[model samples]
Structure formats: structure tokens, C-alpha cells
Target chain A: MIEVKELVKSYGVTGVLRGLNLTAPNGQVLVLLGPNGAGKTTLLRILATLTKSDSGTATIHGMDVAKNGELVRQSIGVVMHSPMLYGDMTVSENLAFFARMFGLPSPDRRIAELLQRVEMDRRADIRVRLLSHGQQKRVALARAMLHSPRTLLLDEPESGLDQRARCILEGIINEFRSADRSVIMTTHQIELGLQVADSVAALERGRVALHEPASAIDIAQLQARFSEPTEALGAL
Target chain B: MAEFHSERGSGDQTETAPTSEQQDSGSPGVFVASLGVIWAIARKDLLLELRNRDVIVSIAGFVLLVFAIFTFAIDIQQADNAELVGPGVLWAGIAFAGVIGLNRAFSLEMERDTLEGLMLTPISRDLIFLGKALGNLMFLAISIAIALPVFAVLFNLVVFRLELLAIAVLLVIGFSSVGTLFAAMSVRVRAREIMLPLLFLPVVAPLLLASIEATADLVAGDSWSEMSQWLQLAIGFDIVFVIVSAVIFQFILED
Candidate 1:
């Protein structure tokens, strides 16, 4: 389980997250819905142990995100909008490099299996520079899952992907769910989020405007919640 | 069928059991794994350079050109002073070529966003710095190997002396060590092409002077005892800069 209590994060003079609280239990997908500059990326980066929070406590399972960052990194996998892939290397080589960095047991087989899972086995030998944007995204996805992490934090995983690529991604997320892994993804694709997310949290002015299960809210309610304009308020 | 394939794919009997140990010990294995990561990055760079031949070729060509220019400017054959001036000419060639290679080495990473991917991995930033430094050192060594013979042939100097060889190694170590660290820092800054040489040359001036002096003594056929003090200074510079660079590289990289 992940519990964020009174989380507060600021950039210079501006506060992005203001006493925001959220909870996500195991075996559930929580989609954070918000428009631009809603602090969605900031919140996810903090959760992924890439950025720091000014004042708050985020605990993954029982470990504190700030105090026990290495532990948090070990348990979580993050796939941001940027592919974070080396263009000069082959697809399988990229996966193997990451797996080796994390010291995965049997990295060779793990890399091969991930390639097959992402359905990039046929192009595994080709340099990433030759692959399309969507193919690179698949490789990035496989790279993120190399360690079999428990918590998956994806920021715009479906962005820039075609319909076929979107289906491949949805299939991977469903696989994560069946493995009993917890996932938190932020996406603008409301239809895709509705199809897979078990719960949804909408953010406005760095606060949770709506937090409920997907079954509890219909499409109209979600649209209304997301479309509400944020007031220009000073930092808390 | 999917489940069966997943189970068989893992090949571990404990595939059904949870990997609780890994979760409990979050980073115990990471430190050891970092060594492998460092080796892999350096190996990849080395292999790529070997295949493409751009860095090596450019460096060698640049060194040869510098030597040729110096030969015309200095009139080596007319004067019996070739031996006295040979060391300065060789170091000038190496230093100029070293800067070019260092700049190109780092630009390779910047061109493709490879450095970003490397940084996102769960390894210490220092290891990344070290790996790149090692790669630069190897490339510089190769450049020296090709240039040293050309220098001997062009200047009509005997190149097979043990003292000369040792002094060459020391000079290479001093030049490339500082070059690698400064190159890593400068590559990320704005206007990096102009910034790298400006940042590197000033900081590395003392080592360069010391190397040129030591090499001049060796080429003059001075005894080891006579040149020992200068050699110590060169060694001291290399050790100090390498340690300081390793400690401060993480800060630069983070910024």
C-alpha cells in the first residue's frame, strides 16, 4: 500500500502540492486526472523518488519515500513521457543494460522474456535509432519492468502512441494487474483510463478535486470534475 | 497457456513464490551491480569507437597535422637541436589532439540522449563519471600510440628509450585524467564547444608544464635520478586531480 499524508512540495516560491493526501492499496490502478500545470508530473516524480517534497510523508508499504529512497526505488518502476532510451544501442542491449544495472537474477533470460512480452522480439537486434517512436516506447516499458517492481508509476504512458500501440500498452497494464502489482498512471486519454483504471483521482490547484472508484462515477461526472477551472490562488 | 509460458520462462522453481527477499533488501545488491554497470557502459563506448573509427581517425589526423605544421615552422633537419625541441613538439600535438577527442567523446553522449538514459538507471552518478573517464583515457592512449611513432619518424629521433616511454605514459595520464573530468562537466553547460577548452586548459596548465619538462629531460638522455623530482610532481598532480574529480563529479552532474 502507498499512503501520502499531508504532502507539500514547492518550487522556489511557488507551492505545487499543498497538504495533499492520497492512498492507494495493492492490486488497484489509480489514475490521476488533471489538465496542464496541475502538478500531476511533480507528484509522480516525487513518488518515483526522482524529486523531493518540501514537507510531507509518503510511505510505500511501510518505507518512507524521502528517508528510504533506495528502498522506494527498488520497489517502484517509473515510465515517464520521455522514452529514456539510448538510441545507439540495440533493443535487447538496452534492456540487458538496465537489468544488469539493477542486478536482476538471470538478466539474459529476463531481457529475452521482456522483449517477447512487449512483442519487440523481432526487432530486438535492430538499433533503437531505426525504430519508430512507438516501438521505442515499448522498449522503454520493458526496461521499466525489468526488476518486477511492485508499484508502477506511469506518466502519460499512452501519449503519442497509435491505436495499435495503445492496445499493446493496455494489454501490458492488464498483465500488471493480474500479477497483483499496484499501478498509478496519469493520462489525458480519458477513454483508455476508464477502460482500465479501478480508481480515479482528479487534481485542481494541487488538491484532489475528485477521488473515487471508476465504478462510482460515470463519464459525465468525470468530465465535469476534470473540466472545472482552477482559481489563481497564492502558494500555501 | 500464458501462465504456463510465464512460469517456464522464469525458469526458477520459486516463480510462484513472491520475491519477498528482494523487497526486504532494497539496495543491498545495487552496490555490487554498479561495477557491472560501469564496465558495461565503458565497454559499449569502446566497442562503438572501434567500429566507427571516427574518434581515432580524427585524433590521429589532427596530431599528424599539428606535427607537420611544427616541422615546417621549426626547421628540424637544418639544426642539430631536433632532440632538444622534440618533446615540446610531441606534447603540443598530444594536448591539442586530446582536447579534440575529449570534446567529441562527450558530444557523442549529448547527441543521442544516451547520457539521460544512463543517469536514470539505479546507479551512483560517480560510477558513470568514472566509466566515461576510463573510456576517454583508452582513446587518448590509442592516439598517443599512433602519434608517438610518427613523431619519432618525422623528427629523426630514437624512440625506443625506456625513460622516454615512461615519461610519455605519465604525460598521457596527467593530460587525459584532467581532460576527462573537465569534459564531463563542460559538456552539459551552455556554449559547451567553447566552454570545454576554456575550462580544461587553465586548470591543466601546471600538469602540462610539468610533463613537458619531464619529457625534455628524458629526451636529453638524463638519468632517472636527475628527473625523479619532476616525475614525482607529475604523479602527485595525477593522483590529486583524479581523487578531487571523482568526489566533485556527482555535484556537477546533479546540477
Candidate 2:
């Protein structure tokens, strides 16, 4: 299980995550909701072990995020809005490269399976630069899963996906959940996140303003929660 | 929500996923893995450059042209001057061509956004730096090979000996190490073209100076005893830069 206690991160004089605390168990998806600059990305990055917290403890399983960052990284798969792909490489080439990086056995077979799962097997040989935004996202998803990580952290994963691509992404998440992987996804697409997420957490000015089960929070309540006036002084 | 489990099952785990304890047990495995990653990056870059041909051709052409210019600029027929100036011209060509190659080494990664993608992989940052450095070294080495023949042909100088070869290798290693390190730093910054030369030249000056003197001594057929000091200086410069660059590279690579 992922456990966080009073997680705090700051950039110079500006604080991002302030005493943020949350948890996600296996076999479920936790959707993080927040507007821009609300520390959602920072929190997720910290969880991915890409960024460090200033003054709190974040433990993935029982390993401390700061002390056991490599362990945390070994267990997590991350997909950022950037897609973070090599445009010069073909989709299949990119996947194989990451497979080798993560030292996956039978990388070729695993790559084929992921491409087929994402329904991009036909375009696997195409260079990533030629792929559309949705196609690139699919490739990124496949890249993330190369190691078969137990925890998935996606930031605005559905932003550029078309309806079909979105459906494929939802299916992927569903499959991960069924396989007992814990997922923490951040997105502004409220209805889509609501549909798939087991729970929702909202951030406002670096604090968790609202967090509850998806069933417990209605659309109106969610919308109103985001509408609350963020204190200007605290908006750094 | 389901609970997150820290203990991952070993059955489906790939060989890359060594348990945390194994990873922490001395770091030899990590080092070996890093070397593998570096080799892959260098190999990939070399394959791409072989296909593209622009960088190799341009750098080789530039080094040849620089030698031609220096031939006219310095009348090598004068024995005293030829012995003193030959080393300078050789190194000048190398340094100039090296800068050109290093500048373009990361051009592909930056243009294609491959750098960001590489960073996201669990590979250590040092591996990325080493890989890029090795690729730059390969490019520079090839340039040196071509330039050496061209220098001999253009200058009408027969300074190609075993000692000279050793000095040339030392010089290239020193130049490429700093070149690769600074290239990584400049690739991520704005005004990179301006920034790279600015950062590289000052740091690499001592090595270049030492190399030129050593090369001059070798050309003069001076005994190893007399030239040993400059060779030692080159070695010292190379080791210092490599260690410094290895430690500092992560800072430059981190977002």
C-alpha cells in the first residue's frame, strides 16, 4: 500500500504540497483533481520518486520515498502529459528500448502484447513523430507498462485522447485494477475520471480540500468544491 | 480503494527488477547496468550518425580546411617553427572540430524530445551522461583519425610516431570528456550555441596547452624523460575532468 503523511514540497519561497496526506491500496484507482498550479503534478512526481518532499514521509509499500527511491521507482509506472517519448524512434523501437532499460525478459513478446492491447499493433513500426497525439499517448502507455509496475501514476492521461483512445485507456486502467495494481491518476476531465476512479482527491493551494469515495461525491459537490475562492496569499 | 503493496511478486518480475536489498548491496550491479545503458546509447547514436553522414562529413571537412588554413598561415619549412607550431595546429584543428561535433551530438535528442523520454526511464543519470560522452568521443575519435592523415598530408610533416599517437589519444580524451559534459549542460539551456563554447573553452584550456606542448616534444623526438611532465599533466587534467563531470552531470540533467 502507498502511505503518505504530511508530505511537504516547496520551490524556493513557493510551497506546492503542504502537509498533504493520502493513501491508495491495491486493486483500485485514485483520481486526483485540481486546477493548474494546485500541486497535483508535484505530488504525483514525488510519488513517482522524480521529485523529493521537503518535510514529510511518503512510503510506497513500506519503503520510504526519500530513502528507498529506487525501490519506489521499481514499483511505479508514470505517464505524464508530455508523453515523454523519443519522436525519432518507431513506437516498437521505443518500447523495446525501455524494455531493455527495465531489463524485461522477452521484451519483444511483451512489446507485442502491449501494442496489441492498446490496439496499436498495426502502427508499431511507424515512427512516433508520425503518430497523432492519441497514438503517441497509447505508445507512452505501452512504454510505462513495459516493467509491469504495480503502481501507475498518470498525469492528465486523457487530455488529448479521442473517444476511442479514451476507451482504450479506460480499458487499460480497468485491466490494471483487475490485476491488483494501485493507480493514482490526475485529470481535469471530471466526468471521465469520476467514471473510472474508485476514489477522488482534490487539491487547492497545496492542500487536500476534499477527498472521498467516488460514490460519496456528486458532480455538483465536486464542482462547488473546486469553485471555492483560493486565498490569494496562499496561491504561491 | 485497494491497498498498495510494496512487496512485488518475483514470478513475473524482469531481471532488471532486482530487490532493493540487492541493489543496495555494493552498487556493482548498478554500475554494470549503467555501463550497458551507456553502451546502448552510444551504439544507437553511432548507428544514426552512420546513416545521416552530415556530422561526420562536415566535421572531417572542417578539420581538413583548418589544417589547410594553418599550412598557409604558418610556413612549416622552418625546422624550429615546425617543431614548435605543429602541435598547436594539430590541437587547434581537433578542438575546433570537436566543438562542432559536440554541439550536434545532442541536437537529435533535443529536436526529437528523446532526452526527456530517456530521463523518465529508471536508468541512472550518470549513464545518460556517460553514453553521450562516449558517443562524442567516438565522433571526435573518428575526426581525429581523419584529421591526423590530413594534417600529415597538408603540413608535409612526418610526426606520426608511437609517442605522438599516445599524446593524440590523451589529448582527444581530455577534449572530449569536457566537451561532452559541457554539451549536456548547454543542450538544455537557451542560447545553447553561445553558452556551450563559453563554458567549454575556459575549462579545457589547460589540457589543450599541455597536449600541444607534449605533441611538440614528441615531434622533436625528445626523450620520454624530458616530455614526461606534460604527459603527466594531460593525464591529471583528464582524470580531474572526468571525475568532476561525472559528479556534476546529474545536477545538469535533473529538471
Relative to the true structure, how large is the alpha-carbon lDDT of every model? 0.75, 0.78
lDDT of 2 by residue, A1-236 (tens): 88889998999999888899898888899999987889999988887777778899989778797776656666778898777776666788778777766666457767777788778999998978889988999888888877778888899898778778888888889977898878899987777778899999999889888889999978767767685333421331
Question: What are the DockQ scores of the candidates, in order?
Answer: 0.24, 0.29
Q: After superposition, how far is residue B85 of candidate 1 from its true place, in Å?
A: 4.2
lDDT of 2 by residue, B1-255 (tens): 111221222213544633335545758876576667788888877866875765677678888888888788888787676676778888877787777778887777777566766665666666777787887788888888888887877766677788777787787777777888898889878888888888898888888888888877777778888888988998999999887887788777654
Mark the regions of model 2 whose C-alpha exceeds 4 Å error after superposition.
A227-236, B1-14, B17-34, B51-58, B76-82, B111-113
> For candidate 2 chain A, which ten residues in a row score worst on lDDT?
A227-236
**True lDDT of residue B17, candidate 1:** 16
What TM-score would candidate 2 get against the native?
0.87
Per-residue accuracy of model 1 over B157-200 as CA lDDT, tens digit each: 87678876777677767666687788888887888878888988
